[model samples]
Target: MIKRIFAALLCAMAAACLSGCAEQTPPPEEHTGTRIALSMASRDQFLVTVETSVLEHAAKNQVDCTVWDAGNDYVVQMQHVKDAREQGYDALIVNEVSPSLTRGILREAEDMPVVFVNREPEMSALTVGKNAYVGSDDSEPGRFQAAWLNDYAEEKGLEHLNIVYLTGIEGQASTIARRESLMDHLKVDHDFVYDSTAQFDRAKAQVQVGMLIEAGRSFDAIVAQNDEMAIGAAMAMQAAGKELCPILGIDGTIAGCQGIRDGMLSFTVRQPGDEQGRAAVDAALALIAGESLDTVSGVTLGEDELSLMIPYEPVDAENVEEYIS
Candidate 1:
């Protein structure tokens, strides 16, 4: 009876131990508390591509990243910058709302790293901050578009052609550079007129462009600063019975590629928005780790200046289907 009692006690104790072991949970996974903030100008297709690309790179590097859209408001962007700085982010990647507005706010980031991905404002602190920029040359694409339009018009035997320029948010460096490049390469003798600044608003773009066509504005081509505006222009032109004109846009988005294939637009410069985002993350990491970033002067695509001097492919009817589809 004593042996049986002892055995019963041992069995109970062993079962309890086994149950406790079974109920035990593993330790919590360690998070490094390293966080980076991405501030984009708007929710348009160009920014979307860059944001998506950057997120992919961030995940691979185990970076805890948060992205914010400024809605194209300079004030809101400044507030976002202030919030990002105050929230103890390890780094900041800014696609500033206005190229100039964020410079002053960046001063608040004393010692906290800040990187500029797309827009380039002459922030005196940029070099001192040990920051790097990543973007393709916006100017070259503008030039390429201008020359291509000229060539196509001549091929079609269209003379006395008039250009209608649809600009982006007024002060973006890309806008300035692209417009100037377009003017410089296009036939100076012909007319290149500014239709209006859509300010990166797609609906506004459609409305304003539709009004222009309704006003009977004579234009041989509609030149949009980016793909979103180009799409809006196409819709407006189609609605107004002026869709026959060649519509050119920048930022070779998936939609832009599709536009060319469907004969909605003449051509687009394939600028990789994704590459910009991925570069921003990689550049920020390099900056934080005290590693040498390649001296990217003009504009950077990633950690390097890839084809800085006009690397855009003009997606036309012959190649658009294969490339875009």
Candidate 2:
């Protein structure tokens, strides 16, 4: 009887160990609610603001969102697309490193809905029902700049002004559109005394502008595709003990707005990063729910019905305080 009791006790102990093991074992990952993957081209300051807005909006709507920075590499962005697909993300929002690579990104995404933000892609790669582009019109900012500059020229009684043009990344759609539109819309006769690509980098702009100053290149005003380059040009002028001219920039970033208040930047066109980001998220959610892109508020669909544009606002010293905070 004692031997029988010992065998029963051993069996009971074995049963308890098995039960504990079973309890410790993790269950299969349950596919829960909607999930979205936001793949950014890089962690630039402007993009960071957009990212934050995206995250905040997603959370408010009870959606699971993940972000991946591609570090300005198309190859990495493609990999991220693949991972998002394999990991069962319901949708993707990408800020493409190169607009030319949009087709490859679309191919990698397969049937997954993608909302491209900030960087506009080729129209051919976008489909009305499958993919979409959400951002401000690139040409609009340039026109806004041109309007302000034209008024400044008129006020200064300058018939023909010598301008220094600082461009963004060479071959970028924004760079091309902004430069062309600014040139096309400006009312005053202006000669581009200096023109070069600053690659949207502040240091590069500073260095290039300093070299122009050192060489005694005469210019009445400076125009940059983005705020960073504009501020850099301002810095170069200050260092040379030159009075600041009408320095124009785009993006209306915090620094840019502050520059306006400080008399460093004359004005900037606000691109509304926060609005773009929130709209992108809303667009993604709408797509996930099988709704039309137009359902997303405060965005206007393009003529092709594949792009959604948020309007740009102009900020100058007169109203710089409104944008600064």
Candidate 3:
């Protein structure tokens, strides 16, 4: 009986030792370098340019980056976030499909850090410790447009300007902010002859402008939310045998820059797609490494010192060559 009792005691001691050893063992080493999942909202021209920059920066920084195209679907974007979390992606860089859908994305990310680019999420969705945004102030581009138009109108000696405003995606934050900024700063004597949403597509803008022209709406200038829309409007005006006036646009894309050089567009706001992309990558990597916003290299953080806004470069006939291909 004494021997059996001693054997039982020895087994209990061994079990406790094994349990302690297991508990003390460290988890398997994580993948080297900062692993990130870049969730793109769509494959539009601006986004494609940004994606190229992101890839270049990722290669330079040796970050393990994977891209998932959401195809402009909010549901797919949510699924992408879920998959990234389960796949152990260290961080998520999302160009949200829609800002209003941010809550679902945030909830799906749980503890994983999400670095939003281009489109902004709701302020409430930005958890200080887990999320950050990187982009230009949307209003700045509009202000730039207004400033240029104001100067142009003064030079042209126009007393009360007739304007046609071409807008982007209807519910987009950019669309709302840019329009508001332009309207707020526009000269008091200006008249809005026509305003319509073109969904930021050149084809759509062209069709809408053609219809307006057919309807006999007269305007001295066209202010587009983006270069594509401006270009489209120009094409429509040319097709209708109407005299084309100074058409302004934002997003100095390669094509947009060419338009300015060729005298198709009056001017454009060059929102640095490449620079923004690089900055976003750096921001995400910093978040993954538990680094402060101040430590993010090459990005100027906002007053909150968490988000980064790249300065908008104005591209017109004088500076179009520098931005053009």
Candidate 4:
């Protein structure tokens, strides 16, 4: 009888122990969301458009994002990165103030995933696991510019060409790639009459091109690294009462689209800022979620698989309307 009673007591204790163990076991971890930091080089028109797109997509993807404008200053940009890290950002999207300063940025960013956008850094600085670049193939826009000019010349049965090239900020990846591609390809059959940096500024391009026109420098074509400068060059030409030649540009901005519609710009390559912005956000989220870039749509790893190049399209009278909408 005492043994039976002891057995009943042991069963009750075992049941109690099992219930206590069940209560003590932890549930699976719940994922709240991701926080992102976007540091911009400046609030320029193109970047502003990109910023808006990023915000739109971030909201759609349930990622919290904050943007800090670096005002084209390297020191300020570095500070922004540090702040983002201290604030516990899951990832960073930096439009570097200068491409050369990326080394410092990576050092300051430490463990955070960085998606460099618009202006790209050196390939050596990029790494597949932690850091990546997001931009149009820096070479494609310039190549398209040259290719379109070539086709136009061929179609019109034109022979000689005089070109004025307005460059972006010196040493920038985009500026270097675009200028090199255009000059190398165009020089095969054309003369570069005036080639200089307009610092990616409309007013600067206007002043420089105005001076070129005033000096009676004759050119049959003008190519600017970006649409803002291209539009500015066209404005300078209009101000001088000179007939507009084939004014080509890249970054098919809204202004550039209007320029094509208004017959001020001959053609522009659409760099798809919206797509780039969305890609950056998506890539950031994917990194936070520990997902592979290969599984992500609208993104591709570079040759070394360390960067992402968004596709670019040539926009002109033929296909400008689709982009405008």
Candidate 5:
């Protein structure tokens, strides 16, 4: 009965893929009896969306899933992994609080199949056949942001500009990759007039940018590591009655898409939360069943064979409406 149900679930997933659904449809009822545990780094806005999708897909596939939130604490996250392993979970999906802790978490998991989502871990920690990662290529979003900014500058006839840069939590893999790649790919001559870490918080970003405004710092553009900080910068400029400049961000979140529609954000790189969440669940199940990760639909394995990458799309005014809902 379980095998039949799982087979039907795979067919449903394949059908959704064929139909070109951005968010894959979940299978009907739960009868597979597969149990998995999702250990999350935090319940941040973007991650909450991923969690919702995971729960939805788990329900549809009849997998028993338990979610543990670490409140952004690596120690707490490690405890969750230990719990999952000791409790006899069929598989474990982790959104690590820190990529540096991947090795420790893997040690706790022992021989259990593990899938790391969103937060990219070090390559050394991942063994292709044993564990894998499912998320976007962190560097791509930065490249997209840089390309858009370059074109914007060219169109404006600006040879050089003062830019404000907002970064996520310091030392995080995504923060490093996004910032470094943006700097590497940017073609325009620019100076970072105001550069600081907003820790991926909207309020923090607003406060920081507000201070810059108070100090009378001039900048031609704002680039944030994620949509939350980007939206916060927009709010700060509006509150101070300052004319908005081209604000660019990653994470094509709902609010980010809306910001583009409202002319608050110039553009964002859309990271499909729903797709990543669904892929994480599917990967976990496959590993538990002793199946290959390549068999998973709607995701491509990274060259390392330890990563299942979801592509990122650029979203701007020209196509923002399509992502608004």
Candidate 6:
């Protein structure tokens, strides 16, 4: 009996020692560099918000960072990604030019860490690179924007309502998703007529609107995918003596909100820029520690790279004074 009790005690002691050793193990080594590489499709109010948010977060965390503007060119952004990877950036963030180009980006990363923010990529998996991912859901913005537009249309009793959708860089993911989702809702539910997609660049959107006006076409509403295009469309509408149309935009930038206050913009939506910026840092940190982004799953941009779909709500003249300008 004495021998049996002694043996049991020895076994218990060994198990406790193992459990303590496991519990006391330190986390994995962090990445060696303080540098991060960031690229955006272009510099605009919306992109600026995302950039500023990321830069500000990096600054606060004492992380060294460099940002590049792709000038709205997929080729240029592609080269930038290749260069960033070669230079050994600790982590990379890209606001992709289009959904189609995203896989190419992943392939070029060479197993380095990468993440996409507001603009989601088209890859079908949660993991794109060895330690990276695209972003949050692409459909949430569509639903939110569609529901608001539908409600507003219903309230105003808008029939034969015409809206012009302005997009960013032709094939960009957010731009395409926003347009398709809104159009689908309009066609099947609201019976709205939103015709044509105008590139979201300020000059281009204005030019597109001008062509429509010159051709004797008219729109009852002008909807821009981002604030830059919305403001540009407004300028063109005023120039063409078409100011009677209601105008709406996304990316509730300071300027966009100001436009709403001035009665020039009927509404716009806000994205979670700060959260995305911080998320990129958090993801990189997790990767460096040999942990998976899956650890932050519930909060990781819908459990992928920081691809979280934040709700964008309508901001109009009614609430413009309180929130904008």
Query: Model 3: what TM-score?
Result: 0.87
The all-Cα superposition gives candidate 4 an RMSD in Å to the true structure of: 8.1
The TM-score of candidate 6 is 0.77
Which segments of candidate 6 are over 4 A away from where they belong? Answer: 1-33, 125-129, 133-136, 187-194, 294-306
How close is every model to the real structure, measured as TM-score?
Answer: 0.83, 0.88, 0.87, 0.87, 0.89, 0.77
In model 1, which regions exceed 4 Å deviation?
1-32, 295-311
lDDT tens string, model 3, 1-325? 9999999999999999999998899876555667888999988778898888888888787778899899888889999999999999999999988988788888899989988998877867687657788888899888998898889878878777888998988788889999899987887378888888988899999999999999988888899999999999999999999888989999999989988888889999998888888888888887878887677656687776567878788888987888875
Spell out the clash pairs found in candidate 1.
135-300
Ranking of all predicted structures according to lDDT, beginning with the best and ending with the worst: 5, 2, 3, 4, 1, 6
Residue lDDT tens for model 4, 209-301: 999989988988898889999999999999999899999988889999999999999999988898889888877777777776665578777
TM-score of candidate 1 on Cα atoms, chains taken together: 0.83
What RMSD, rounded to one decimal, does every model reach? 4.8, 7.0, 11.1, 8.1, 11.0, 10.8
lDDT of each: 0.75, 0.90, 0.86, 0.86, 0.90, 0.71
lDDT of 1 by residue, 1-325 (tens): 9999999999999999988887796665676667899888777777787898888888877788999888877777787778888998888888877656655756766666778867765544466436666666778888888888888877887776787888887777888899899988887346765467987566777898888777877777888888888888899888877646888888778888888877888888887676667778877876787765653333333423321222556667777776665
Looking at candidate 4, the ten consecutive residues that score lowest on lDDT are: 179-188
Q: Candidate 6 lDDT, tens digit per residue, 44-118?
A: 766687788788877776777899999978799999889988998877888877777767888898677777776
Return whichever of 1 and 5 wins on TM-score: 5
Give the C-alpha lDDT of model 6: 0.71
- Which candidate comes out best when scored by TM-score? 5
Candidate 2 lDDT, 70-144, residue by residue in tens: 998878999999999999999999988888888988888898999999988887977778888899889998999
Deviation (Å) of 312 in candidate 4 = 0.9
Report the number of clashing residue pairs per model: 1, 0, 0, 0, 1, 5
